[model samples]
Target: MGSELRQAFSVIRKAPELISPAAPTPKEFKKLSDIDDQEGLKFHVPSLFFYKNSPSPALEGKDPVKVIREALSKALVFYYPLAGRLREGDNRKLLVDCNGEGILFTEADANVKLEHFGDEIQVPCPYLDQLLYNVPGSDGTLGCPLLLIQVTRLLCGGFILGLRFIHTICDGFGFMQFLKAVEEMTNGANSPSLTPVWQREILNARDPPRITRIHHEFEPVKNSRDIFLNMNLDDMAHKSFYFGPKEIASLRHQLPFHLQNCSRFELITAWLWRCRTIALEPDPDEIVRLSFTASARGKHYNQLIPPGYYGNAFVYPALCSKADDLCRNPLEYAVELVKKAKAEINEEYVRSVADLMVIRGRPKYTSEGYFIVSDNTRTGFDEVDLGWGKPVFGGIAGALLIISFYLKYQKRDGEIGSMVPICLPLSTMEKFQEEMKKMTEAPM
Candidate 1:
């Protein structure tokens, strides 16, 4: 099936062009938050949303490319920073020039229909590159288009929107806000219901930066258990694991009554971290870390970061444990660690991370023995409506080598769950699947 899909799917794209704002916007430079310009967020992140043709009379005979292109131009008037070019100043601090340079846009036509993919589109999509072409020299962080979008029309009137945005510009929630703005324009709204805000200074470092908390996320490690460093890309495989109601029930059954009430994110992250560590077969005494980002927007610091502030406003909290202990302990052991790490992300924790970035020269998140899980199930990526009804499939186009995303999934029977995409070495993948099977197949 994979080979056939790969052979059958193809996209014929037009020359990419710039889409500027429909109206004039501010002509000035906007500084990025400390969390925005971090070394870990210096690259582009890709996401794709597939929309089946809507049956609504309002959307009938609508050209998605034309509607979206025009709507994007209008949306950029408020999100002008996205239409601008990124520039780096002294200290490697990043800022948007906000010069109305326009964002990269492309229109394409695909040979296949939505059904060609399958009932459910899985991650590590085979034709992601074809769907979203990476134009030469467009992925850099300095003086380049911050947002790149491609609209691919399918044979069955469905369309796929492919986006590649600079991570430094916005986090997942912020990006979704921008897309929602575009959706508002497509629906005939004059402007976004929520006004765009660029008060990035709210997340700036202190006058004299002071590290108030221990931030293990940025700690440098020597002689680390970095498995990916020695392995080539070809040796790894990506697969999506679905956790439906039954599977979740099975997993819950494995835990004690008290631990069974843990949130799905904690349960899944703990299980995957332990299973992944066992699969890698790292040294028993070696330290393994589980890293995840927690948003501070609506937390205790909600008053600090106002709504519509589209920038990086999250903290990377990491939990560490010995491989032997992590693999040998009960499921509750891992859950407790995850809960502890998540509970520590208060306002002070965020401030300390910002201070740490300045004090440590903006070090990247440590990758050694790291298993990162990002929960997108609640991000509302799937619910984005743009004239065409909600997308059939939405979220990250594929999985990264080190980071996995917990995406929303709904089965034909209407059972809703989470879909996690994981990439691992081929040999390790087999072992990982075995571990996962054991968890799901365990007796009630």
Candidate 2:
């Protein structure tokens, strides 16, 4: 069946073109925030969203590619910076030249229906490259288009939206804000309900750049036996794990009564860290690190970040432990470590990180003994309505070597949970599965 579907699936696309703003925009240079230009965020991230055919009589014969193309131009009027190309300045800092150059856009048609993918479309999608073509010389951090979008019309009238955006420009929430603006344009709105804001200067490093806190996420670690440093990409296997109410209940059962109230993000991060460490079988005394980002917005910080401020306003807090300690400890032990790492992301911590970036030349996150997980359950990817009701599947297209995403998923029986995608060495994948099964099958 897979081979037959593969032979039947073909995406016929027109020559890609640039779609500029419908109206004139400012032609000036806008500097990005310190958090935005970090080494870790200089790459492009790809995502996919599948929309079913709308049954509304008012929208019967519309072409999604054309609709989105026109809406994208209109939306670019407010988000004009995204229409510009990135430029590098002194100290390897990034700034956008608002030249109104526009973004890369493509229109395509697929021979297969959305159902051919699966009843519940998950990550590690096989046709990701076909749906979102990576144009030559377009994936660089400098002198590259900030956003690339593709709209593919399926045989069943359903459409898939593929997106590739440079992470140095915005985070997940900021990208969603821009996408929502396009959806507003498709819905016949003259302007976005929420105005766009690009106040990157607010998160800049201080004059003296004082590093008050120790940021373990960016710490320099010299390990001769680093598992990631010696990994072969060809030997890695990607797998998706679903955790619903039952799975959560079983995992919670393994925890002590006092730690039963841990949030789902903390629980899953701790559990996965333990299982992955066991699978790798690192030295007993080797250090293993788990890193995740925490948002620095909202009233808790006295509104330091204004509403509509779409930039990278998050901090990567990391926790580390000896491999033997992490694998042998109780579930609650790792849970407490996860909680401690998350609790350290306050206003001061964020400022301190900016200082560290400037002090350390914007070093990338620690790669030795490192694992990163991102929680996208509340990112509002699934709620995007582009004249079609909502997407059947909306999130990242696949998993990276060391990074995993926690995406929101709903089962056939209407049970909502998280679908996490993980990539491990082929030799260790079986052991990883065994450890995961042990967690989810614990006695209730």
Candidate 3:
């Protein structure tokens, strides 16, 4: 394909980094943003954006670094909530003190080019940990800025932006909404089309909070220090597969008559769940779970959650089946289960989850025999024209050791396509490939 792949990417942080607009020591709580009870979620969401060289104003004659820094500063004024610090509140829950402590903004230089990135999607994951900003040993809930950003210039004028936001501050939707605002500032727009929604009151647990509807999907978290602690961590491999319009259309046509018009995300997720469970080959009694996030903006719970409501408005809807049954079930059965999980995201479910979190009081989530899926197909990352035409690669850094990334394909070998990047143990990947072949090669 291109030049020989480099094993490790390199970077050097530019000097004199700024954590803008220093603040006075605060003991009193004048401004506080509370973290909602979402049953379970991590403390931080890490994302990456790799942009190719372009002739836009920000990348034109002026220095991109300086322009970005200035634009971010202006952006902070509008999105003032982001320039806060994570602190503990009542009940040991996390809350943001909107004290304007400012964001940790760093500039760096990379040794790779744009083409080196998109060509092999999964290959770049290991380097992502280096590219993103994470406090080495923080609980990810406290003592870290709500927002941390890194802009790295690459060998061929290409650059990558790293964004890590404390989850309590906002979910993926809110984060992208924030980026859209910053992009406007970079492009000299007066303001964003959607303003940040600050009313967390609607999402607060009921006054006499109780789980009105008992749903078995919300399982108590099983604490595990490391997801792959039992396996040799170093032996794991990250793999990616691309499926074009032809493949997606083919899969769609093969679905049950009732599911013919199912969303692409649901179709692919259902297919992935069946494939993964079969590949693992667990006992009949052993349970397997598929957990994916469902956004609550402009959709379910819309009456309670406004259009610009930029916070953790996502709930992880899960479905579990015996490993044996999951492996043997018709694809349509699993697909229907996925459809049911998607349908459970109404206003009652959202309110009940908040109440359940109150009861659980921050429980740990177990990853054993579980597959967490994230579909970035509509992330609007491709439209973030921050003075650049578009980013070559824009997606989340693998949040966990094992995750399935579903997003629109970035490369151009065929018609507009979709891609799935999954990281698994080497032994498991071998079996996974076998199952993938069996499913994809079967006649539609």
The models' CA-based lDDT, in order, is 0.88, 0.88, 0.69
Ten contiguous residues with the weakest lDDT in model 3: 26-35
Tell me how candidate 1 scores on lDDT.
0.88
* Candidate 3 overall lDDT versus native: 0.69
In the range 1-444, model 3's lDDT, one tens digit per residue, is 233545556788754344653233333332232235332455566767777778485458655677677877777766776776666667866666667777777788877777776555433365675576454543365666677778888788877788777666777777888888888878887667787776776777777878876554456334412336577767786777666765677678667788898887887888888877776666667777788877666644556678787777766766887777888778888888889888766777777767777776754455667788887778776567778666666776653565666666555653566677777777777888887776567676
RMSD of 2: 1.3
Cα error, candidate 2, residue 353 (Å): 0.6
Off by over 4 Å in 2: 55-57
> Which candidate has the highest lDDT of all?
2
lDDT ranking from best to worst?
2, 1, 3
Candidate 1 backbone collisions, by pair: none
The sequence of per-residue lDDT tens digits that candidate 2 reaches over residues 1-444 is 566777888999998899999999999999999989899988888999998988346556888888889999999999999999989889878899999999999899999888887753778787888999998888998888899899999999999999999989998899999999999898889999999999998899999999998777888665625766667888889888888888888888988888989999998999999999999998888888899978888887779888898899888788989989999998888999999888777898889888888998999987888898888899998888888878888998767888898899877688899999899989989999999999766889
Q: Model 3, which residues run further than 4 Å from truth? A: 1-9, 21-39, 57-59, 116-118, 121-126, 133-139, 220-232, 299-302
- Give the per-residue lDDT digits (tens) of candidate 1, residues 70-183: 999999999999999888888978888999999999999999888888854757677788889998889988889999899999999999999999889998999999999999
Q: How does residue 237 of candidate 3 score in lDDT?
A: 68
**Candidate 2 — number of clashing residue pairs?**
0
